[model samples]
Target: MPQSINCRVGCPESEAPNTETRAWSESRKMEAMPSRCLFLLFLSTCKLSPEVVAEVQESSDGPGAQEPMRLTDVQAAMEFIAAAEVAVIGFFQDSEVPAVSLIHSVVQNFQDVSFGISTASEVLAHYNITGNTISLFRLVDNKQLDLKGEDFESMDATKLSRFIESNNLRLVTEYNAITAIGLFNSMIPIHLLLIMNKASSEFEENLHRFQEAAKLFPGRILFILVDSGVKQNEKAISFFKLKMAELPALAIYQTLDDKWDTLPITEVLVEQVQNFCDGFLKGKGLRQNNEAKEKTSKVEL
Candidate 1:
């Protein structure tokens, strides 16, 4: 949190309610720096790399417009604003000229998004009839800008910090057999496995399955995907004694008990994948036969 922007009594402030704050669109308050300077400011405050800045600057003006959803009225805008931690508001300078700035303000009742205009109530005031459109950018926790004040000019490098510090990501990274052994060592106790050729459809299907699973389980289970076609994978293939033809197979690795199981499903559909995952949780789907194990085993990486 930063010092509130002092403005008209009803002005929108960033963050908490009752904080005396002004609108970022208050041109009198937010001094316009050169494009290069503003670019550098974004680099420092937003923790953007030089390459990203260069890429942004390379664009003629800016990226193509994908207009954000606009709030309908004051009631809707107030509701939208109240729910957000941080929001960016876009305002039109005239009929065509548009500009935006970040704000942390508690608001209530509007349409699809929270909105504010320079007015009497100091709350969401509908400007739709006036042809003034505003867009909101909801900035959540994690890598985010934490400036010292509501004024954009006040942002300094020292104030920027990461909200979350732990490495909780669950995406499956590319790996070979040797690297796989070292990788999963630190993973959470329970993990699922998907073995498929990187160039094949099975790889994509499995990837989607794991990513979707993340929405529900989050860090509870790890999804590791391995490319079974590579030379590095051959060692794992031999370790599991899998034949050449059975390339794509699914398995689950339980680190707590040091066990692995071959999933029963031959096809990688969403429902079947979920059921296989459920069965693995129950400790039911282990390799049943030596012949079946030899065909399905593609040691997880």
Candidate 2:
């Protein structure tokens, strides 16, 4: 016995066919077709050209240029500094290297800015007493102000005391000679202050880790990481020495902590250490393998 299946030439078996039903079935067949095939069918049906569709596609995916950052206005700068918590002061010294000072700062007037530090702050003394002509800047929101012809003067004791009271900053009790004062005629955007503080905090944490590593490895390893936030010359050098002394290993100094993994130690020095370690490990492995082979041979004999 055999079974036979039959299909009508122009009708679907699922439903009864009429003019509307046949038209709907034809539309569904066309919709189910591949896009390229449908496009060809559409062009054949409408007698339209392919260039129009190609133009539309190009317009949707075209490349565009990004807008540049606009330079901030004075009012924007004032508002930024008024709300800032930390600032870096850049100054030039007798040495070729520029000095950077990080301190708690405040903005007074639109044109006048002030920073407070103990009179004993070596950085302040160097600029004020040493007659160091330094350029000061403030950064916020990736905006920077390059302050030219900046000057620093001692704040009156009464004003200093008032500033301390207003800002709730601690007065140095032990150093009566140290006076706190504000810096005026400076330039820096306020938003950058916050960014600098965040960066400095991260740098300090990485620096602490580097110091710990140095202590563990001693003379066998040396680490060098620089802290850009460290503005005081003596303090920066002292910190460097303290970290180096922890390990009798080679000297390690860091210029800036670039998130810890990639240190900016001299490239040549880093290569040397890596090569040495690799060779030492290889040699040790070879010796172990040789000893194991000797034992096996004796057992076989």
Candidate 3:
């Protein structure tokens, strides 16, 4: 005989697990089942499919958007994490009677939800939820964040490094000379350009736009961002003959041709950058070795 469970919203309809319920006998005693398997069980028991489950979130103005349902399985959790940039997840502790703790977590990926799990949902489906209840809550409204350093939700430059690493761009630092050299010597022969300071809003926006434009060339062109104000990058600055007085400058170096073209990026704009890169690639406009001069600018970081 199989056990019956209540339907959505504690509806009167009761459903049985039927013939497939035997496999879940031990899982029922396990307390916390693997989210992926649990999801499959949920779909089977409810007579639902992925397409039906996916329609739960119809619109941003819909009821589900205001109050997201508790994440019951891996698929729903992954979808929730992808839709919400910020979220609050509830997990049980290791005590005899597990107590739930609601913690705020930034969405890194589907696998790295609130708790310390790093495996993707597919991988996590093979293992149990580690002997505790875990649930994800969506974040739709504005909420105040704890800015104190101790709070896990706070993010710094080190945390932001993971986001940058995901991108194919090489982050050039003082000690990255060798790495830069290796990139310059790649099979495709990289055309290296440096965006001196990315902290400025204008520069960051322009750099993002430039990166979008450069995506068409793929493995051919590469851009490195360097904050030359750091004391350790003195060698890189000196090697490139860069003037600290003009910190926010764009320098393009091609070791293959032994050519260096520098320009002071006083104005950060997409059209201007596209034109410059286009001209450079077409061999139309390049500052002479002596022509790329340094100048003072008011765009402070």
Q: Which has the greatest TM-score?
A: 1
Q: Please list the C-alpha lDDT of all candidates, in the order they appear.
A: 0.37, 0.24, 0.35
- Per-residue lDDT over 85-186 for candidate 2, one digit per residue giving the tens place of the 0 to 100 score: 222233333333222221212222111233322222354343342333322222211112222233123323332223322222111001011110111001
TM-scores for every predicted model: 0.38, 0.15, 0.37
Global fold similarity of model 1 (TM-score): 0.38
In candidate 1 the C-alpha lDDT for residue 113 amounts to: 26
lDDT tens digits, residues 159-245, model 1? 111111011122454443222322332224555656677787566666786667644443355566656666655544443344556
The count of backbone overlaps in candidate 1 is 19
Who is ahead in lDDT, 2 or 3?
3
Candidate 1 vs candidate 3: which has greater TM-score?
1
